[model samples]
Target: MIAFTAAEIADITNGRLAAEPGIIPGSVVTDSREATPGSLYVAKPGETADGHDFVAAAFDRGAVLALVEHDVADAAGHNYPAVVVQDSVLAMGALAAETVRRIRAAREADGQPLTVIGITGSAGKTTTKDLLAGILAAEGPTVAPQGSYNGEVGVPLTVFKADAHTRYLVIEMGATGVGHISYLADMVRPDIGVVLCVGTAHAGEFGGVENIALAKGELVEALPATGTAVLNLDDARVAAMAGRTRATVLGCTAQSAGDAQVRAGQVGLTPGGSPEFDLFLPGDPNGHHVSAKLIGAHHITNLLAAAGAAHAAGVPAGRIAESLSAQAAASRWRMERTERADGVTIINDAYNANPESMRAALRTLADLGRGRRTWAVLGAMLELGEDSIREHMAVGTQVVRLNISRLVVVGREARSLYVSAVNEGSWGNECVFAETVEDAYDLLQAELQPGDLVLFKSSNGIGLRHLGDRIALPPQAPGRTATEGSALL
Candidate 1:
């Protein structure tokens, strides 16, 4: 990432070097499949598979070295070039921290500036990261995560993508417990920290909503006094973070009447459910208008958050608006709208979910399916802890209130939603519960019409996104039609 030799990498990671003295890894990766020449592979244990097993595979892909918890032997019975550490994940973080330090030092020596922006929240972190990246890229070179790569290992992998020529690094920080965001902040040390809304996404893991706020605030807490903190004024929990950091605070809100330094006014949705609004910045009295290609009104807050960070990075208001308007949804499975050739519309937001985001998607679905029949194929929202039942019940009630045509709850974990819908007066065929994704797919296939709008939402674990993908497919050929007992589409 910063042209560090094997000796320097071992020293920086506080690990013993077992490789050739002058070897240098140009990049760092965790997956063996992504290894290339001059690549340093970090072999760590994962939930699904142990990365240590792929060390030889990585080396075979032209990797110069591997960072591992145990030494890896080559075909010659000799230890391959490696940096042996107690924990390969932590060693990778150390290497990333040093890479950032080196890039900054080099930029400082060349009188160039590199602005690192850290974004965190219970929901919308990836969307905001994508939006900010688009706005920042218009100003200069920017590096951002590919998708929702905002976890412990993901942050360092994103950091390793930065170099001296990189002008902006947008780091999305996600936390399941206390100190998680703090741990990420300690690595990149962002110059501008943006805190979006703190919601009940991870309330179960953090024990409560208050703990979520505490964890998300760590991003702002890591900023320097000279840096700026862009906070969401609409979310009281995030707004309270103004006192947590020494950095100058810049508040952003979706309301024009608010006292926020940056605000959005005249908000409205396009026919396709995308949001369009007048953007108000800090200095420019007459603000610019931005119509984002991103769907749902919930994106207004995300757009404002991106504008606030872009403003802090010295991007002009007009350029920010232009960049935002030109951008489309870059990440997959989050309000991903697909129009089938048969005239059916599919909204696949099954990437991940929480109470706040769930409500937002349901509302957007209701709005977009105004005159057309609507189908909500939902699954369980995981990690909601003790509030799981109440939250799920509330979503069911909201769906009914929205006047949706049909509700299909998939899986036993999501039984609460089906039962709540029935209890909420949606009886008989109005609400149906399926035991699996295949059952849900069959039910929708038999009932869906050409003009109907279907929405698929759940935590990624539910696998409903694949169901949405299957539903998005055009009508099958006469002989290739799906059968009840056939394999999953």
Candidate 2:
């Protein structure tokens, strides 16, 4: 973070000064294990653990200041050097807002400009952020979220990494309900907002799919009149967002939608399942062709969203295309492709799953496994509210329609998928129900043959990604015998 004394932080956050820390913090950390010299540790509460419990460990590891809900005591019973606030997470947001103000003011004084881009959607937030970051980083010093760090705490942490020299700030915003994105946007005050498709990923928390659209539109609604809003025209809900923001609308479309500012023509996937398309930016008669390193045809929208955001940020269209083609999936487990020496191609897209992404993944699997056997080890999509069972059944039906060779549904929550697949004509050995990841592992270990393609997909909490990691290993590795591997079939 920008240099800040404990007093300054206390004032910025409307917090009270505890024991005077007489120190200037150079960075911010939430996890105590990540604390370093001059770091300000945030004692925020979590679902299972409280951050207040780690304050002392942070101090011992070289933290100079702590932002806490209550003053923490030392061995002498006196309070540790800290800034006490009503809520540490809210204080972090306050600090982040102030940090952005300072950075922008400094840049203005130097005749340079700081560009902040906010990206949000039910899916594709991280992938788009990664793509935008890749293009922006080549232009200047850029700061984007780590992994899926797009929540209240995650956004502030991302802002803390920005300094005076930082030229571009790319934030991924995620919301569970109404006003969540607005709350995040109030902190960073983005110059450009990118709204990818609003899907059913968080339909449960937001009450319904319509509410999700309302929530995701908050990012564009937060943009200034002078700013730009990048909306995916392929999604009707997102296309409707153009009217919701005062900012200029820049539409990104894959299907040659009418008058879209960013268009992808002749879209097709490479043999390896990466999207290849002709990218047409505003005023470009001749579009630049991009053969993306990302693993699915569905990523064409993400590519266009990034291209639109970069163009709004003042990068040339040619440069954006070149950067995008070279940028593979940077974050883990989002169609992350791993080819073992045994000729097994494991597409680990287990980071997170929704109906739209699940279908995209299944289609990509069908394309990639054209002449080879395909296995789909799917877990629950999660948080669909009333639509959960229907959605899982839909995915199972798609798996059968796409002609996926084997179906292994790994959890009780996702048992509907197995039943639906069998009901949809995947009878007998084609579809199997495994009560646990271990059972699925055993089933696959015995059945998977050379040239068999596998896809692991589920919500993050399902832990299917770890199973994918275990199964991706070569059969001859360490403890497993050929006889044991041969029996798994």
Candidate 3:
């Protein structure tokens, strides 16, 4: 972040200062526990906890400042500067935005252009952001959103990560209601806006599926007339939003991406399970082969989304393919596999879960379990609000349609998913339910067999990672090199 004095921050966030005349706040923080030297702890409140309660803890962590809406007459006891605001969370974002504007105006970092690509959708937003950054970086430097940083606070923080040296910026934009995407897009002011797809991911939060479509459309809606909008031609909802964008449209999808300006084809999985495909050049027979390290045919769609965004931003096709094939899975949870000592294969996709993601996971699980009995350990998807039960039920029906031999549903709400599966199928005796990760662990330990394939998935709230770790025993014997070293010693 650009070094800003208290006076500058007052101007940036349009807030009052309760501290001394001259203190330079070097960083902005949301979590008081993570605040340290030169940190400005923003006293924001959450559903379960208030950040103001931890002001003392932040000082212990060496924080230099505290940003608060409440007047801190006794901040002198903590020996740091304090900034008073009507809302600390909003002020933090305001300061971050102003910092970015100043950085961009500096024309620093050898005069390289800052190309920001804002990505929005119901699903595939993170994967597309990761892939897009990798592809664009094949030609030059890039800075991508870290994890699922696609919201109000995350968007500003992502911008703060930018400096003159950042050749490209790939930002993920997420929305639960109307105007969220527009707010993030305005912050990023991206050269290219990508609408990956619109689905029921958070439809309940936005009131309905139609509202969800409108929310995701906000990314392109905020685009300037000269900017480019990358639309997923295969998604009817996303495709419909294209006409609403003032930007030039570049469409992408699988070859069936009807009338796409760019498309991917000849796609399939290797025996090892990575994605392999050819990206069809727009208006030309010329194409480039992509060997992405991600698994499943769904990744082809993700790659095409990233490809179209990168192309609209002027990245070459061959470079995009090389970038896609060169990167490993950006994170372990997407479709990570672990082999247990007892010979059980575990796919740990427990980082997050949604209806679309759950369906795709089940399909992959079935394909990988061709010669083996497959088990699915599922937890509930969050943020669906009133639609949670129905969405889980939809996931359950899809599970029954797949080749899963057993289903262990963990957590409270996910029991609905298991029930739905039983109701949708012929009550396959393979279904079981556990209220907690520990219970799921005990059941798996007692029942798993060699040659069994198991998939564990859930939203972040379910703590499914604990269950995955419990069932994932270490290898019985060390690798040959380690054994040799032990013998020599």
Candidate order by decreasing lDDT: 2, 1, 3
- Please give the lDDT score at residue 275 for candidate 2: 93
- Whole-model lDDT, model 2: 0.92
Which one wins on lDDT? Answer: 2
Candidate 3 Cα RMSD (Å): 5.0
Of models 1 and 3, which has the larger lDDT?
1
- Each candidate structure's TM-score, on Cα atoms with residue i matched to residue i, is 0.97, 0.97, 0.91
**Prediction-by-prediction clash tally:** 0, 4, 0
The whole-model C-alpha lDDT of candidate 1 against the native structure comes to 0.90
lDDT scores in order: 0.90, 0.92, 0.77
Clashing pairs for model 3 are none
Worst 10 residues of 1 by lDDT: 480-489
Which 10 consecutive positions of candidate 3 have the poorest summed lDDT?
480-489
**RMSD after CA superposition, every candidate:** 1.5, 2.4, 5.0
Model 2: lDDT of residue 190: 99
lDDT of 3 at 435: 81
TM-score: the better of candidates 2 and 3: 2
